[model samples]
Target: MKKENVVIITPCFNENTTVIAFLKQIEEVAGKLPFLFEVIVVDDCSSDQTLSMLQKFSFVSENITLTILPLRFNVGHQSAIYQGLLYAQHLDADKFIIMDSDGEDDPEAIAELVKFNDYDIVNVARGRRKESISFQISYYVYRFIFKIITGKILNFGNFCMIKKKVLETSCHTSFIHFAAHLSKQKVKSTSITFNRLKRIDGKSKMNLTSLVHHAFKSFVEYAEELLMVFLRIFILVILLFFGIIGVVLYKKLFTDEAILGWASTMTVNLFTAALVCVGFFVMGILLLNMISRRNQNKTEIFVKLAEKSELLNQN
Candidate 1:
């Protein structure tokens, strides 16, 4: 086969219900593109028939590569995506796009994503979402927390095109805190909005609870990136202390400086309490860094095993 220049990596987990239709739609969409392209489905050890579905397609489409990264257990969605991105990098695709196995993220938007090739990455903004009211509320809360943590406004959903280099670089990053990390590089980005469709086949793999967990983990993963927050807090604390001291000194100089008893005492106590909380939050992050280091070590071990397995199969 001619060298495949562009590829689409769709991460799957128990998506057997939608895999066939999704693959068919992807095929039709790719057929319209000008260059040679491949669709890689990274199966995340689905307990359902997802593996079998991918096997069937693998036998048929010469250009289609189905990578079954069967985890020892049920890895989360983001981990599955990272695995797909790794596969794409290994396959040497010039560019790659990640989409959900479910049809909600339209595969037809790939053309618009390709237009922003000048940028290292472009995320497709879901102009609309087909989600329950509760999910919508939770999503906005997560977004607010993300902005507070990262100090930047992030746009778009996970659906978008990324250069091969950005995909590889992002996978290795320790701060998995924000999806915007994919676009954090020096790259121009443009957004294209697509109407989010309701699921046609399988139920959404992500629920409210799972979404909450994902949001938390991503924030923790990117904790180190928020060092500036710590610095700013420290600076504010110093300034606040000085400001309070100046106020107290001025009052003493101008007034008789009498009768200010419990209120003044309580105010100082509150300032001290705030400082203590900030200290603990910073230390908690340090603890998290230790835990993340352990996770990265495990990931490295897995990568080694994957590499050895590949070498053996090649031989």
Candidate 2:
């Protein structure tokens, strides 16, 4: 029987110190699997030696192939992965896997992710993160807000194996947040819980500000749904405003308690505040709608400037 082609896409910015070890780990994992594996390392125009290191690296296993995609400019992690996926579209592959180049995304989980052929996508849900307390707190908060906004629980990152069809479907949409976008897909999917590992070398690239920005990007992926949610809230607030006015009028006309000037002033002030809130909500909804439209029309700009390095092993 012919072996299936499996492509793995990993994006890195300045991971020169840990990238080699990560690639070696991937190579070791690929050697044990029966499928033919191709690893695509997308370098986000690293200012350091990341691109050089990737270009010089060699794989020992015959089953593994290394393809390095160096972008013309730094397009961030999500876009880097998108570029990798776009590049992989031309390759003949059965399954595509996306994971972080840092050691945090355990290479061993690749085995577990690929075992299920019945599913179109198999994701590695984050069980426990080994980051600092503050980072953990912030991540939990982000997840909470994501649940409140998108109405979906996000337990997975960009660590999963996807079929070619899923890849094709995803390539059409904006991959602002890979896992979040994939979660919105209607494909057959399953997830396995796994503890996140620590980095192999150097400190984490993601800081508090970056985490917040990342969370915002994920929210952007669900802009349309979030807009609808806010619209409902806006409508409810308008109804409540009218209800309050009705109650005030009834208290003045029917109730024995006299509505003083202070009471009338307070009611006007409250309604004025509500009107401001309504204005803000309307602006927010408009912004979200614009973002949703922009995302839908987003073009694959990375394809034009990305340069592909030669495959590590010809044979």
Candidate that would win on lDDT: 2
lDDT of 1 at 308: 35
Please write out the lDDT profile of model 1 over residues 1-315, one tens digit for every residue: 464477787777777758778877776666666656677666665777766655555424454444544454556666667766655667766688888778988878876765555777777876677888899888888888878887655556578788877776766663343365564666665667788878767466668998877776666655565655665776676676677667777778887876356547755765786687588667767866775685474252123334534532332
The per-model lDDT (C-alpha) reads 0.67, 0.82
Candidate 2 per-residue lDDT over residues 201-268, each given as its tens digit: 85787889999999988877886777677667667766766776787799888998766666566667
TM-scores of all predicted structures: 0.79, 0.89
What does the lDDT read for residue 170 in candidate 2?
73
Off by over 4 Å in 1: 1-4, 58-67, 174-178, 221-225, 242-255, 259-262, 284-288, 291-315
Give the Cα error of residue 273 in candidate 1, in Å: 3.7
Could you tell me how far off, in angstroms, the CA of residue 18 lies in candidate 2 after the best superposition? 1.2
Error of 2 at 267 (Å): 3.5
